[model samples]
Target: MLHGKVVLVTGAASGIGAAAARLFASYGARLALLDRDEEVAALAAELPDAVALPYDVADRDAVFAAVEQAAARFGRLDGAFNNAGIEGLGGGMAPTEGYPADEFERVLAVNVRGVFNCLAAELPRLPPGGAVVNTASVLGWLGGPGQAAYAASKHAVVGLTRSAALEQAARGVRVNAILPGAVATPMLLERGFRANPDFAEAAPGAHPMGRIARPEEVAEGAAWLLSDKASFVTGHTLAIDGGLSAR
Candidate 1:
């Protein structure tokens, strides 16, 4: 329970972000939902005590503005789930040497730099006892076969979460990351299927549970991390995968 708290979630248009938004709201938290997609507005509209903000995570100014606006609207900022990211073009499944230079740069811009911008903007805005959870990936710890850029970006996110947690420890703001594996989000399904027709169908075999995680499953972990229940937790990388990394 996040009752009486004001929380912010980026990438709220869909997938894990949107699922987190819904779950947090159900816990009685006021929500500030941000995403570049216009659908964020619609998602926000469906929830009670929610405000949708349209902005790009890669845009530093836009990230700051959204944080400032959310805090202002809620009267205070308590926690955030920085989840906006891109898998990149070219199906995000190219061999390292064959990866497009521009796509690699774009992935870093959105996945790595996007988290950097959000942390920079949100840290100072958080009052004491605030918490933040970044959405990294199982690839953050394990190298992907044909996903060099994505793996690198997520690794950066993991490192950033730790460094930030240390910096804000004395300030009573906890920063952490969640590494999920093959969640059945559109991002995973669409691009993966594009790269290999069997991607969507075969993903379940990659997990020991015999199924990829659902967006809501990942959201549950995020909700717990962002709540006061995790007050003693910070600078930790939680693997929400269905035992994918155990192998």
Candidate 2:
């Protein structure tokens, strides 16, 4: 599917990003796994051909540098999964009026600016037929109570994805976004639910499938988008939400 391609995956230490890295590797892609977590190196070590890039996507200059480093190591960048993001301060579900200003800024820094940085750094380097997938969320489409910052940031990612797609379409570089529902990721199970226990039970029911998604399920959509199989697809938002968006 991705034979000989060099793909970059941000936030590759765990959850959906980690799953995407492993899946891309299995498809014969060389990987440039970037994460703030040092554990990303161990994940890279497990792969046949991968290099762990320790980076914080919020840093614009660092993101550009890391992208360059990946191209240098792999000879070219064929695809990228810009999946580095945060659920914000405690899933960012606090009442809007009481939501801390600093926390909101922090969420925008990592979620919004992170994707912006990646796109700016990556697009020029990707050749014709190369692809990029930005990780938005089901929250990007629908609003919920007490999730202002996260919802806002993800919505921004959707906007960015569409705009980038339009700009790059004629050049033959496909750009798309994936909107995923609740998934069993450490950020959600460990951090999000810890902050709002009620959601642990409620989240599954919110999806029409009546269950949270496995990280690999979401990764499958990403892998397809970044492959030649989705050659004609661009500027599209594919929902991997198990019918949450249908309702």
List per-prediction Cα lDDT, in the order shown.
0.92, 0.94
Q: Candidate 1 residues 73-187, lDDT tens each? A: 9899999999998887646478899989999999999999999999999999998899999999998999988889999999999999999999999999999999999887788
On residues 39-153, what C-alpha lDDT tens digit does candidate 2 reach at each position? 9999999999999999999999999999999999989999999999998776637888988889999999999999999999999999999999999999889986788899899
Clashes of 1: 0
Per-prediction TM-score to the true structure, in the order listed: 0.97, 0.98
Error of 1 at 170 (Å): 1.6
TM-score for candidate 1 = 0.97
Stretches of candidate 1 off by over 4 Å are none
Q: In model 2, what lDDT does residue 103 have?
A: 92
Error of 1 at 122 (Å): 0.3
